[model samples]
Target chain A: MPELTARAAPPLAHHFVDMRQQTEAARLGMWLFLASEVLLFTGLFTAYSIYRYLYAGVFEEASRKGVELWAGTTNTFVLITSSLTVALAIHFARLGRGKLAAALLGVSLLLGCAFLGIKAIEYANHFHEGQLPGKFYTFAEVQGPGASMFFTLYFIMTGLHGLHVIAGMTVLAVMAVRAWREEFGPEHYAPIEIAGLYWHLVDLIWIFLYPLLYLI
Target chain B: MPNGEHQTALEPHHGAGRYVAVWVALCALTVGTLLASRLSLGPPWHLLVALAIAAAKAGLVALFFMHLWDQPGVNRLVFATSLVFVALLIGLVLLDSATRFPLANPPNERTLRFEPPSFETHVQPGEREQGEPGAIGRPPARE
Candidate 1:
């Protein structure tokens, strides 16, 4: 593929290079997309920080008791392992191993489901304990009532991430089906790679969230 | 919509091992950040360290996880512009929050009796005399 020039007979993605240009273009788009994601989550992180500052003691105590560090840790490991598998999927796809890539993608999806299932259990427990935010929170251990704020952010942030996990799983499922069909090959596997990128970001966010919510 | 426009369909990425290495580095950084948070660091340092780690993690994700590092600089420029915009957005928000109260002048009158409509769901199950409809939503976490 010619550098920066439209090919007269381009077999590349309509918006990209021959395979080379397409890869670069797609990579660029993912970064821009990720930038947007960073900004989106930045709002939540900022809010959490400011709130923690104002109620440091309360949040500390809540952090110490309100959340299960083990649960969060397990989830973190789940995500990171899935990230590894997704990375492997991309690796295999690069080697033109579509079936393996698809299989790994499926494994990642299962792990994602496991993560969500754990998240659901955690959320349900919080709700049962009335660990929600605002005035409604009623956990016996969260003294000063202001501690509800921590749980509020906890639920909202993790809940949002859980939703993303669901979305990611749907994407993985589709890719797995495509891989099974032998659609992605030496010529086409960008979807798997992009999906890998998205999954990694999800894992990265959890890495931060785990400590923020669990470790004081 | 075009074939190349979306990366969803394509051949494998080059330098796959490099991206994998970056991902491992990211995992290490995550553990480091968690350890750093446990120290009795001052408030500013605590935030600084955490944010630094976050920046590193985000960089790794962007560079390798997303392969932006391998792409042309045009994409980087676009991504950077959005960063600036996001900073601006956050700055404006901080300014609004910081200046909510007058430093010098005292308020002539403040109303405690009148209830403001809340964006969050009612925190309590029962309704009070001043039942505000707007308050019926999830309680937004301030932190």
Candidate 2:
């Protein structure tokens, strides 16, 4: 039996006809917000592309010389795994397994912290090495123009991403609290669903960021 | 807006096992992309290959993990429309930058050249003097 018709329409916000309509509106709203988020990141991506194009060789050398490739790969794995856990959390929420969902979200939140921890280590390494962006850049390994530009884009893109991680963790924490309180169940887990979507978006951005910043 | 019942019917209830499967696939693709970067394809091919793999991984997360696969078409269109506009933004910038004349481009060590010597500079031995008959870029001498 489908869960949709299992009970009368869950609590409504006055305008919605039923629970289904509410969920649809919630999802649509989230997607639209995601679209705006995409555009926000596109500006940084465009800057990265333009700079890389103008200084192809310099960008390659700077990335090779300054970046810790293995660290980046580790963070990539961490974020992807967290994405999996968060998805599982939502699954549990929909099944009315409140404790299990809460636990999964807790793990996801911890992994996000781990990611930021690793990122801080990387940032400290760069700072100590004088790999600052633009005029502040002083690393001697890569010489000539555009080296600073690489780090500039690097810090800006990853810095913004790190902020998103923090934001997602906060949202997940809220979801975890609600799950523990039994606020979400088989029929009323839309908040968890949307939070999961936001966390996935964080992971999705890192998916692209990994290649653009670390690999190529 | 569709009613609650219709949206509920549309909701997919794929089990945790299926989500795990997508997760495994995403991890494999990540490894594939990392290895692909090590290949010596060079330039656009390497970049394109890596981005293609990333896009594949992102698509999996969006469709399965984010439940976009179960959502209505309007939701999908909103997201896809954003991507189309992004493409337009990047495409226009590249078009403008890629078609400029070489001299008009940014100054870099790659484009530097030594200035050509003028006619007043010391001429090599056995070279015709400036203004001499048949000399290039010199006025013809009176017969």
Candidate 3:
């Protein structure tokens, strides 16, 4: 192990031998939580697969006719950019530039809001056209037994993802406040890094959702 | 912990430039997928191509943005296991459906077991046959 530097370490938890062990434990715990999140989305993806496989024509028609591809593409770009900013926030935090880190996080938060705004527009369009889930579906352009099922999955999957975005934005907002307070520095920025992991996961889910739902 | 040794053994700190480069790559891939969708790849090819691009984009986000590239083996294991279960769930279910008897799956619209009632043909309860036993607004027949 590398020798400890002369600077005072953060207070080690009573249960851990050193700061390194505690940090590792925290990271591992976050990964475990993220794994569970993956499984949660996995179930929904499986449902999408089954329906798409059984009603291939319906999904194709639904994607081409109902969904707004431009919106999805734009949101993908926005999220990818936001992911970069959040990653940069962590980078700046590690360099002891807390203000810069907070600035990056603030940008990320704005991008997240933009994402939600675009989604709201799309949802409004769907609502106006009556392209809703299950029995609420009324758009008549695409017709088949599985037509409603497609919209149902689309709403459920994307709705759940949007909720995650809100959660991620909340986390980023808090991290931004802390970064602004200069609580994160080279010696301790795990909170920022962990929060970044979550925001990236939200982006990761959207990456798959775009092609599956919008591109078909 | 020494400030100098603060860097974890597995997780290397990447600079801002690396993140920007990944972001650019992700954006490019997003555009690539969008353009690919316009192609008349037909049925399975379209889905395969789109999913492949999505997977690539997701991989970039996870490895670079999420720092899985330099993460410890245990964290990687946790993620990989979750992915394994995902694959199993989708794969096995697809296999079952694919191998099922033709009649087990919903019949194609053209071959539906019964004709669905259209709005024009839908009957109102008030318009049902009058005086029929047990009909709406009518009394039941005695045994």
- Model 1: residue B82 alpha-carbon error in angstroms: 3.1
> What's the lDDT for all of these models?
0.70, 0.83, 0.84
Candidate 1 chain A least-lDDT 10 residues: A1-10
**Model 3 ranges with Cα > 4 A deviation:** A1-9, B1-11, B107-143
TM-score of chain B of each: 0.57, 0.67, 0.69
* Residue ranges of candidate 1 with Cα displaced over 4 Å: A1-33, B1-20, B95-143
Model 1, B62-100: lDDT tens digits are 666555665546867877787787677667765664465
Sorted on TM-score, highest at the top, how do the candidates line up?
2, 3, 1
Predicted candidate 2 versus true structure: per-residue lDDT over A65-88, tens digit per residue: 889999889999999999999988
Docking class of 3: acceptable
Q: Candidate 2 lDDT, tens digit per residue, B32-120?
A: 99899888587889889999999999899888888778765798899889999889888888777677744455754343342444664
TM-score of each: 0.73, 0.86, 0.86
Tell me the tens digit of each residue's lDDT in model 3 across A1-216.
111232245556799876567777888899899989998999999998888878888888998999998899899999999999999998877766778889999999999999999999999999999898888889989988788898999999999999999999999999999887777666567788899989999998999999999997
The residue-by-residue lDDT of candidate 1 on A62-151, one tens digit each, is 987888766887787688778878877776665556677789898998899899888888888888888888877889986773487788
